[model samples]
Target: DAGITQSPRYKITETGRQVTLMCHQTWSHSYMFWYRQDLGHGLRLIYYSAAADITDKGEVPDGYVVSRSKTENFPLTLESATRSQTSVYFCASSTSGRLGYFGPGTRLTVT
Candidate 1:
């Protein structure tokens, strides 16, 4: 089974456009997270959900949105993509406070 996966491993879009990154996992973990990795910022949590329909904004939730309607899928959308938003996005899942399993990230570039 694919533990976790992210679609459109690489994406390029113009500034002000809308971009959606898809993430899926086979495990039905109780928690799921979305994070972005940049050169100096390292990894910053963008959003997280404890269960279906139960989501919370993370450290950097501005300009982005997330939803978890199912235990296995969490999708992230950028309302208006910007150059500064270009980064590698990772999706992770875990049980309660357990260690999370991260998916292969999606590298996004906005011009």
Candidate 2:
């Protein structure tokens, strides 16, 4: 889903070193997504999953990973952290192809 292509791209929320951000939605939406927000680049898609155990790569999936094992939970993991990976991550869910809701962002900064 090339969803909500034009929303506020600024970050809302941080982690240093190996970090994992978790997102949980009570609405039981089938689609979940992960994005990273940076000052100049805005929000870049990192990964998304249509359902539990189903996932896909997005624009900037490199160095990032995601998993969905339950309908309400989506977790993002950053491997071998690098300074370039520093950014605020956002998690979102939607029933249709467009994004409907966004979780509070989690910041990750690799030193």
| Model number with the top TM-score | 1
> What stretches of model 1 exceed 4 Å from their correct place?
none
Q: Give the residue spans of candidate 2 off by over 4 A.
A: 1-16, 97-99
Instruction: Please provide, for model 2 over 19-109, each residue's C-alpha lDDT reduced to its tens digit, 9 standing for 90 to 100.
Output: 5677887787899899888999988999999999999999999888888889888888776577788788888899986657887677655
The deviation in Å at residue 99 for candidate 1 is 1.7
- What's the CA error at residue 61 for candidate 1, in Å? 0.4
lDDT of 1 at 9: 100
**Candidate 1 lDDT tens digits, 1-111:** 769999999999999999999999998998999999998898999999999999999999999998888899999999999999999999999997688999999999999
Assess every candidate by TM-score: 0.97, 0.80
Candidate 2: C-alpha RMSD after superposition:
6.2
Candidate 1 yields a Cα-based lDDT of 0.95
In terms of lDDT, the poorest run of 10 residues in model 1 is 91-100
What do the candidate models score in CA lDDT, each in turn? Answer: 0.95, 0.76
